[model samples]
Target: MITVDFSLFPVGPGDRVLDLGCGGGRHAFEVYRRGADIVAFDQNENDLAEVADMFAAMRAAGEAPAESEAAAETVTGDALDTPFGDDSFDRVIASEIFEHIPHDTAAMAELHRVLRPGGIAAVTVPSWLPERLCWALSEDYHTNEGGHVRIYTRAELEAKLKAAGFLIGPHHHAHALHAPYWWIKCAVGTSNEDHPLASAYHRMLVWDMMKAPKTTRTTERLLNPLIGKSVVVYLRKPHRGSAESTG
Candidate 1:
């Protein structure tokens, strides 16, 4: 499911976009559909291959706009050392990625380096309280390889991004209803898919995503600011020669 809200992170037609640490290419696909030149960058070769296949399929099926000049390509690389030149992309998406990287400052630096002046970066991570609950409920949740290495308070994250030279903007929370689902999973067992409560919750989430009934949508909107599972922060690279650019 997509976490970054496109309304808050605007991408004009033909805008260059990068989906850093793109897991399964959900956001990349959306960027492509919007007629932006998008690069789905990830470390996993298998996932990149799948994203490439999906891009080809979307082109073949005419899912992209007829007059749109958008194109999508996959890049396999490290987040801390991307293969792009300085000031390359107009927009960058780094959702559900920071928590997984131990050297988050380095990764954030790279994100800042590749974004053009006045470009936007949309970053998301597990919200503090909900993530704390998950960690408390199950040690396995954060201890596994490639699992979340740390949790971030809103202040901590904002400070780090500011230190990286991004001007922080409006922020919001998302996926409120999904918090309890994970709590249930951690309470039972990370791999216990057969748990009745967990299975039922999963089914409900699937239905909500696919059908998007009015009730769930309204409920999620109301609950999001309070207990949402993910926190989305929008940041902008300062325009070149601006006062903030001195950093």
Candidate 2:
């Protein structure tokens, strides 16, 4: 499921976008469909291979605007040490990645260095309360390898971004329904897929994502502010001669 809202970080034709830590390439695919040149950068070679295949499939299917300058590619690399030149991308997406990084500050700095002046970065992480609940419910949830290493409070997230030289912008919560689902999984056993409650919840979530019925949509909207699973923050690099840049 996509976490970053496009309204907060709009991409259009000819925009060069980087989906850092692209994982399964969900956001990168969306960026491509929006007519932006997208690079799905991840450390996993297998994942990048799949992402590259999807890009080819998307091109054949005419998913992106034919007349636009949209293109898609996959890059495998370390987030702390990306191979991009300075100010290479017009927009950057760092969704659901910071929590997994031990050197998040370095990664954030790389994000700032690669994005063009005034370019936007859309970052998402597990929200405080829901994530805390998960941790409290099960040690396995956070302790697993390649899993979330730290929980981010909104203030801390903004502070880190500011320290990285990004101008913080609007913030919002998403996926309220998924919060309870994760809590249930933590309560029962993180890996126990066949547990009745966990399985039922998974089915509901899959249905909600695929069908997007009005009932769940409205319910999530109402509940998001209080218990959303993910919080998305938009940030921008200061333009040349702006206050942050000049300093």
Writing each residue's lDDT as its tens digit, candidate 1 over 152-215 gives 9988999999999999888999999999999999999999999999999999999999999999
TM-score of each: 0.96, 0.96
Per-residue CA lDDT of model 2 for 127-241, tens digit only, reads 9999999999999999999999999999999999999999888899999999999999999999999999999999999999999999999999999999999999999899988
Give the residue spans of candidate 2 off by over 4 A.
Answer: 66-68, 244-247
RMSD score of candidate 1 (Å): 2.0
lDDT of model 1 at position 239: 95
Model 1 scores a TM of 0.96
Which residue pairs come into collision in candidate 1?
none
* Least accurate 10 contiguous residues by lDDT in model 1: 238-247
